[model samples]
Target: MPFIPHTEEEVQEMLVAIGAASIDELFDEIPENLKLTQLDAIPTALSEMEITQLMGKRSLQDGEPSCFIGAGAYDHHIPAAVWQLTTRGEFYTAYTPYQAEASQGTLQLLYEFQSMMVALTGMDASNASLYDGASALAEAVLMSVRANRKSKSKRVLMPRTVHPAYRRVVHNIVRNQQIELVEVAFDPKSGQTNLAVLEQYAGEDFAALVIPQPNFFGVLEDVDALTNWAHANGALAVGVVNPLALALLTPPGLWGEAGADICCGEGQPLGAPLASGGPYFGFLCCKIAQVRQMPGRIIGRTVDLDGKVGYSLTLQAREQHIRRSKATSNICTNQGLMVTAATIHMALLGSEGLERAAAASFQNTRHLVEVLTAIPGVEVMFEQPAFHERVVRLPAPAKGILRSLAAHNVLGGFDLSADYPELGNALLVCATEKRTEDEIAAYAQKLERVIQLQGGVTCGLVPKE
Candidate 1:
């Protein structure tokens, strides 16, 4: 979105028509001290042509770098036909199918999305979508508390291995509602949540237990054990999974004997880009019994008067039309556009294709770890098996090493110092299927140079196993 300048006369005319005396009146709610008097850093007005030229020159300053950071959003390859088909007028301009008859195409697309999610997660039902992964987790936490009729306590066992931002969002959304998020610490050595810690809460009445497949540190957890443990204590198993990883890893529904009650995760890797942290949608799925508790729109396939197959909004017990008390959640709008794109992405890449991509990602990450650890003083931080991302300890401060890598046109990895301070200078690195052997080698070469520049101490190479 480009900035369009307005004429003073046009601005004044618009302001007068809107019942505002001046621009300042519109922002009366903003604190007097907080409002900036002027933006001195902003350059003077330039012609469109001049601005375009200047932007081109500035854009070149930040050369294209190999991406290795996949904390939440990934850098997976989207097929060419994905966006091409998604942007078609019929799909692009379609809004929520409030009147199912008017927006059948949109409803149908959403239904397909839900069906695909069900197949992927092995859940009985799926909602259209919520805002993003973080908000989706908040909704899942809330849903667990409401659906757990057996448990009296609103406590949910949230492991420290869950995404930090997601934990914060869950706390903010659920705390006021008296929902307690009990934080469970991870194993310092493996960067995984051990069952021994979970044993402490064996008899406690908790509404749910969140189990991340490859947790925040990217270490794969024992999902079957965790899910079974949650069920043994009469708690709902809430799985926060990576959709891409679900291609190869066991899904939430197959985790234990009964499987996870609810599953949710970010749908960004499906088709959405890392367009400045995104417009990514979050998907929520649950068993048939818990379908009534799931939030967001749920589209159902049905027969018309003519006995024609059709799509319709189903089990909607939330927002504007429903009574406040009866509503499951306050999720207002649907992430229909993102969901549509993801559907197209999945359609283009069938299950076999997704599995291949997942396998490639896992192999590449393992190879990357092997390559990176070969360097002196650089070692794998965790001893557990991981998916595409893993935490690796750098000999020097991660931030400085990352900055140096950036100068060499490489995005090394995400620095986890501030978030996980105990793991000093630990860098959370990822190598998706998109990363080639050459790219991985280049990253390692530049990283070694950076370490040498920092006078990194030479040490015996630590085995990645």
Candidate 2:
């Protein structure tokens, strides 16, 4: 891939050798209609320095926006060493381990990742990793249907409290299939999945019930009651969780009397930086019996002929591995690099460090809620116990307030109108451990100023009846 400079004389000589007058003549065999006569839309090429300066100036427009938005992706502090070590040539350039014996290092790392995920979720087994949280949830839905041998139903109950993006991805992926995805509404006051509506739909005809922990609105669902209800109705309970929250809250596997059948979530909060939305991994864990139906690769540890320990691909459900028509899943590879980053992050922040981080995030969010709610026209919308994010109703439209906050270099959470239209002028705000006290205060000050200038009035806190 080294650059080679060709001279005009060299080109002319080559053209002459090929019996062509010019480069255009070389492609004379091609039809004229197929050839592009011009590319006027593309800009003229610029010098290296000019291009660099232009890019730098454009990037400066982004400024230093204090992020409070956490609809799904978060802004968490990542240790520098996590990527420093992960980017090593050995780990960076490694590819799919088709030959399991030859990929001991990769297999071992993935095995460790799976082990950590299982321990974190309190599940019997974990897959290597998946495309992302949304797709992982979709895969979890498919697995639930497959695992529910007793049920002849293809219906799944998805909560409105789940991230709208995640739900959309699931619909797009599974819409062509015969499966029916039923939406369960949430309590407008509590912002949690309405247990009343849930009870009506929770029955034998449903394949699974997808529950989001510290759901899209950042309101914690009554997971115990929901899981128990799902079990009682002979439906699999699929918990869409936040991996970081598991540090302080109870794991899905330990929920209810019976426990969640499957657990999956976004792992961006682990150690991955929010590099403009992504490159984050998704994790899925399940009971031991459902391991066979799980998607993606699974690495396992065993002993060799000489009694030496070895690591290899334990199960590959993708079409590439097994019979194409009979394959359990079509996912060929796991998000190896992201998994590597997450494994290192988990190791760096052991159990105690993770607990501290989680506790700090919760406290920071509470602080944010207090300061923001003190504003004249701001109020907390939900009374439920939340982890590190909350929903707040604003007198003015959230979109307008967010734009005003951006003018002050602050990203004031996500607007809830589009997703939850009934929650008028609401915003989903988060304060991870990375948010400083000063940032919270500044956000409050900016928000109050914005609301005042807009002549907005408060409805105060709604009665939690």
lDDT against true structure, model 2: 0.88
Candidate 1 local Cα displacement, residue 262, angstroms: 0.4
Please list the Cα RMSD from the true structure of every candidate, rounded to 1 decimal place: 5.1, 3.9
| Candidate achieving the largest lDDT | 1
lDDT of 1 at 180: 95
Per-candidate TM-score against the hidden true structure: 0.87, 0.89
Q: How does model 1 score by TM-score? A: 0.87
Residue 136, candidate 1: how far off, in angstroms?
0.6
How would you encode candidate 1's per-residue C-alpha lDDT over 32-133 as one tens digit per residue? 899887878998788889989999998787676898998998888889898898899988887778888989989998999999999999999999999998
Clashes of 2: 0
lDDT of 2 by residue, 243-351 (tens): 9889888899999998899999999998888878678888899999898888888888888889999988776554456757676667876689999999999999998
Q: Rate the local accuracy (lDDT) of all candidates.
A: 0.90, 0.88
Question: Which residue pairs clash in candidate 1?
Answer: none
Where's the lowest-lDDT run of ten residues in candidate 2?
Answer: 456-465
